[model samples]
Target: MSTNVLPLSKPVPADSSLRLVPDVPDFVVGPGLSPEVADVVTLIGGSATAGRNLAETRRIFTQVRRALGPTVPDIASIREEVINTPAGKLNLRLYRPSFGFRPLPALLFFHGGGWTVGDLDSHDTLCRQLAIATGHVIVAVDYRLAPENPWPAPIEDGWEALRWLSNYAPLLAIDPLAIGVAGDSAGGNIAAVLALKARDEGGPALKGQVLIYPCTDLSASLPSHFAHADGYLLTRKQYLAYVANYLAGQDVEQDWRVSPLRAARFDGLPPTVIITAGFDPLLDEGRAYAGRLAAAGVPVIHRSYADMVHGFITMGGRLPAANRAIADIGRALASHDIYAFSDGGGI
Candidate 1:
């Protein structure tokens, strides 16, 4: 990592006094946020009901489905399938775009639940939106979560699935050249690891890697982790709880399987796009990772929604910025320059 740190240049937005509903997590428009994005902040923040943290997080995810229903696309086709990873068979939900994929692009996405709670169902809408917004076929991976599979299992599952998907791109009517990987939070960790692995191992080449507020480092030292540690939608305590459960007493925090930023090198990883939120704990790490890619001379686009919180990508359809972010993601995925590094024998 470089010695330079990019300090926040502007004054922070969203003082504690923003107007919101008088009860349980009301909506509030704050600094660096527009009205539409505020609606998403209010919706997600107020969705927290009293319960075990995991159950409460699930409730918030459920509330996300109820609140953001308008943005979800009508599924033209859902092909539920599985892949044979070294650990075992893993599930993948394939979303064929509206125009079809007899010869289209493919995005292999992974869901985020801090490596513990999410599944195909929790992220179905997000995948559908990507499919509809980008006009590409999407394969949502159901890699085993931590506490159940742990460490290398999720990483291995993601890698194997992407490999097979790339190899069978023709069968799925996808252009192998246009294939990419995506994920949020823990899933982002997996996607990033897969990118590093594929590049280093000489497996299938990828067009891009999309990381949404990813947890790039496991040391818990980033400023976002401390700044938004509590009551900013996802508490640092809750995060540690999730990680503890995810790790299950394993001291694998520094392992590349758990922390992709620790990878020995980044020169050959895919062109990258990383998304972050202003008030989320994992925000700094996402930004830092983008910088790492840039320092390695990889093409990268880093976006920060300063008024938004963690898990904002899934909330895109309801919020205009989120929608715009999704569109931006699609464009990045479909761009022609992702492979520019390999042109003219420069790589």
Candidate 2:
């Protein structure tokens, strides 16, 4: 991770296939990425697994995130709760931006760390931001990680969390009718699967989904995955390592649960906002998922930060675009009918 900045150049052409919704005035798509993001990338460097094992990797991942991530914003309230699932106890943190008594729409959020790292604390700042930005109760789930709890465990926890949140909405001052799902990286993968599950299995109806540089395809065969595999923070090697750990020798890359983009149908899923970083390896799949959602008659908002890299959303401390992207997400959530709550004090 050299401090030397890459020479700036003309921005790459925007993907013609992606149809970005122009409703959000503040959420501008990229002609160029923030130079500050590039500086952060240099400061953070490649993967957390370069010379460390799973435990060390996990610790370092959280450490780096906290170091470079955004400052925690003040909120009206934040509370933690425990729920039992098939995999055992799961932890959820709820963030509220105001003390209003009105029942609010909620977003069930999962953190990104390739499913091997990240927890409530790792994503606390982002969740808080969403709470302020979207004017929704942000429920951040501490899903089980990989290697120790691979494949279905994380998604299993997510499903249970979604059901738990919806079933117990009133108690939490949340509107059961306005629930949605969101996550970044591996967590994004889970959110997408949960949206599909809510559609196929029925119950806990979802209003929308916001996937931030989500890993919609675990196969890692997409062209963007290769094109930006190295140099960027999320390298090809690190990504494959995370995939291997999550799979744990299981041959389920094609499974819809493992890879939402591999799902047979996308027609009935909720409205979606897919945010992709131009330099991220997962860029193509995120864009592909957005395209598929649009083609299937689902409302879709696809925005590509042409100059940003993978994991920029969490780097709000150093990246202005990161904060802007989050605000855009808030606008997207608010666009859904169920999310038409009071303006409150949201971003």
Q: Which residue pairs in model 1 clash with each other?
A: 14-31
- List the candidates' TM-scores in order: 0.81, 0.87
Backbone Cα, N, C clashes tallied per candidate? 1, 0
Q: Which pairs of residues collide in model 2?
A: none
Task: Name the Cα RMSD for model 2.
Answer: 10.3
Give the candidate number with the greatest TM-score.
2
Q: How many residue pairs of model 2 clash at the backbone?
A: 0
Of candidate 1, the 10-residue stretch with the lowest lDDT total is: 1-10
Model 1 scores what on Cα lDDT? Answer: 0.72
